[model samples]
Target: YKSGQKCVKVIVPENASIDVYGSGWVCNSGFKKSSTSCVPMTPQEIQKQKELEKALAAEIQRRRAQGVSGDDCETEYKTNAEVCVEITGGDLDCNESYGGDYYRDCDATLRYEVSTDYSGGAYLDVDVECSIEIEYKGRETYSTQTDSSSQDESHSLYAHGSDSETMNFNFSFSSYKEITSVKISSAQCEIDSVDLY
Candidate 1:
């Protein structure tokens, strides 16, 4: 009996001699000794740990590429409405609304409507009046008009009765290489809507 020694004893047959060295204890099959306990590391468990470490490394690299620091990362995204709206309307119409002239070759129609409501009498006719100016683009080879002359070229519309009246005007010029813009001036009436194709 060895006292005050942390040694393990094994009893074999009486005639058998056992060899014991000082290089720790021998572990049984499928087990390993770690400190005072026998632990095992399965192949599946080792593979899972490696995969987790790889995934963590990949995530860290991704965040680093986006200039993220610490534990927080920022990302930007465009809204669906903005993305959809951009697909339809593109570029601003550069034609001056009140100053310059616009030219169009296609059959362009400027429609004007005036409506009035009389509060005092049901049979009374309310009078409404308005005006609009259509400017046509000129050729570079020809001389352009001054501001005063350009105002003279604008088309005007006048209305009498209040109920409702529609006026259509057509001007013939060189086919419009491009559609510019249309300007409206309203008095005693509101502009309902405008359309250009």
Candidate 2:
């Protein structure tokens, strides 16, 4: 009796063929062996991968040419870029409280002057916040408020060729409590955008 009939059948992997000696399996002509399986990688597939890499590189180069960072601006405008505008002056006007040391019905006007470096013309969206502190009967109270100079929600100011603009904020204290003193504790400005024309 021949033992050949008792030999176990070898299972061939997909996309692969049995070796000439019938001892193992090898990947087909157009496929490559990956671990225990065959993966197809024709000449056309290699060409497509190369094309995709080239296109991605071209996109990065185009954005660099336009002065745009890979992503949007990450920091405040004035700190990240050259400061094209500055607060030249600040004036406060207020009405005296009736028979008290405090003043009410106040208006704070901030003036901005554009630098000569950007004389071409620009639109700026600036946000200003000021902290007001008041003392009443030996206790101090603080408050912060915001106002936009632009017609829209964004506080935009358009300046052309070394121009300047003023922003006004109204502050009124209606409480009948007797206040001792009213003063502006701190003030800060954050420039959102500066678009040059």
lDDT of 1 by residue, 38-115 (tens): 455468745654564466467557755876332311111221110000000011112221223444322222222322
For each candidate, what is the lDDT? 0.29, 0.47
| Decoy 2 TM-score against native | 0.38
Of candidate 1, the 10-residue stretch with the lowest lDDT total is: 82-91
Model 2, 1-197: lDDT tens per residue?
12476767667889998854566666675565555677776698456545644654575477568874322232234424333344444544445555435554555555554432323244544433322232223125454333223211134444423445555566666555433344343333334455433
Which residue runs of candidate 1 sit more than 4 Å off their true CA positions? 1-117, 141-165, 174-197
Candidate 1: which pairs clash? 102-135, 102-136, 102-137, 103-137, 104-176, 105-175, 105-176
How many angstroms is residue 56 displaced in model 2 relative to the true structure, after the best TM-score fit?
52
Cα error, candidate 2, residue 33 (Å): 90
Candidate 2 Cα lDDT to native: 0.47
